[model samples]
Target: MNTRIAALAALFLAAPALAEAPAMTVMPSPGCGCCHAWADLARAEGYDVSIRETDVAALKDDLGITPGHRSCHTALVGGYVLEGHVPFDAVARLLAAQPAIAGLAVPGMPSGSPGMGDDPDARYDVIAFGGTAGAGEVFHEAGR
Candidate 1:
């Protein structure tokens, strides 16, 4: 009985520590204000942000990222493409929920988004992309 209890306690303790945070490689054009702002936001949210200054257009093409999924930059997060100016909270939710999708995107720059920082109340959809590189679903709708 003591051994059984010890085993259970070990499992419980190791479970959370084993769930490491996903690493994000952010590729963006140099001197892009909004993109920088977006990366900063993600960093503030405790993401392991890696900024790679590169040709934005080429980076998108190389990663199979298209205009419909485009934003100010591109990010590879947890073995998935995180395109555009996505909110950090949304990214956190995706990693936690572990949904059936290829990637997450916030197409185009919205006014009130973290990167843009204009429309604090602007509405936008956090879209999930499927494995086939197509649109998935509205993962989250934002007003904040």
Candidate 2:
């Protein structure tokens, strides 16, 4: 085999075993009941979740999420921001794809979003927000 081609083959062979799954850090207000509920849901799904209370506004700023894109909570997973009531399944998909996105946000207290509990007829959007306020696209939209 050509030396350069053999070296390339070796590198490719070793890549898969070194890959690591992405993890997210969840930050929520201490007294927020819904946040805890969301945390529980994440835990049940095998995510490495760490809970802490901090100034949400400051956290948002630290993550570079301006006021227009801010939500009730903040999460950091694999260089992605999980703002607000994002569901575990969607989060898993996000981590799996590892898209070029600033973060995933549910925005506001959506009636049936994860921790908010089940809604027989709830509609919400799992929006992917990027660098600016309008740099957002719908990843998932829940419906009745």
Candidate 3:
């Protein structure tokens, strides 16, 4: 009985570490400062982020990210794609829900969006795209 209790305690203690977020691979365009900033923000949020500099245009094309859904950087995490300066909350929701979509996008670099700038009143939309018919839909709205 004491051995079983010890094992249970060990499992409980290790649960939190096991629940840590999966590692993320971020592909950013060469010479893009904002992309690096965004990766830093993601790291601050406790995500294991790895940055890989590459030709973003070709990468976007290969990933099926349409022009309208393009962003300066792209990330792959938990089998989902993230484009641009996507907020941490939105990414959290996507991971939790595990929606049947190709990924999420923030489109252009909004003023207050993550890695863009600190504008309290900036507003932007995170778009979910490439599910069934490959249409884009509003996934989340950020800022004021």
The C-alpha lDDT values of all candidates are: 0.68, 0.67, 0.77
Which wins on TM-score, candidate 2 or candidate 3? 3
**Which number leads on lDDT?**
3
Error of 2 at 29 (Å): 1.9
Clashes of 1: 2
Instruction: Give stretches of model 2 more than 4 Å off.
Output: 1-22, 131-134
* RMSD for each of the candidates: 10.4, 9.9, 10.5
lDDT of 2 by residue, 20-106 (tens): 433445678767888878877776766656665677786676566667666677876655678888876677777677676677888
Task: Tell me the spans in candidate 3 whose CA falls farther than 4 Å from its real position.
Answer: 1-18, 133-135
| Top candidate by TM-score | 3
Predicted structure 1: lDDT: 0.68
lDDT by residue for model 1 (9-34), tens: 24223323224544566777677888
Q: After superposition, how far is residue 16 of candidate 1 from its true place, in Å?
A: 15
Assess every candidate by TM-score: 0.75, 0.75, 0.82
Candidate rank order under lDDT: 3, 1, 2
Sort all candidates by TM-score, best to worst: 3, 1, 2
Alpha carbon lDDT of residue 2, candidate 2? 25
lDDT of candidate 3 over 65-134, digit per residue (tens): 8999998998877667789999989999988887778788999888888898946467899998776533
Error of 1 at 78 (Å): 1.2
TM-score of 2: 0.75
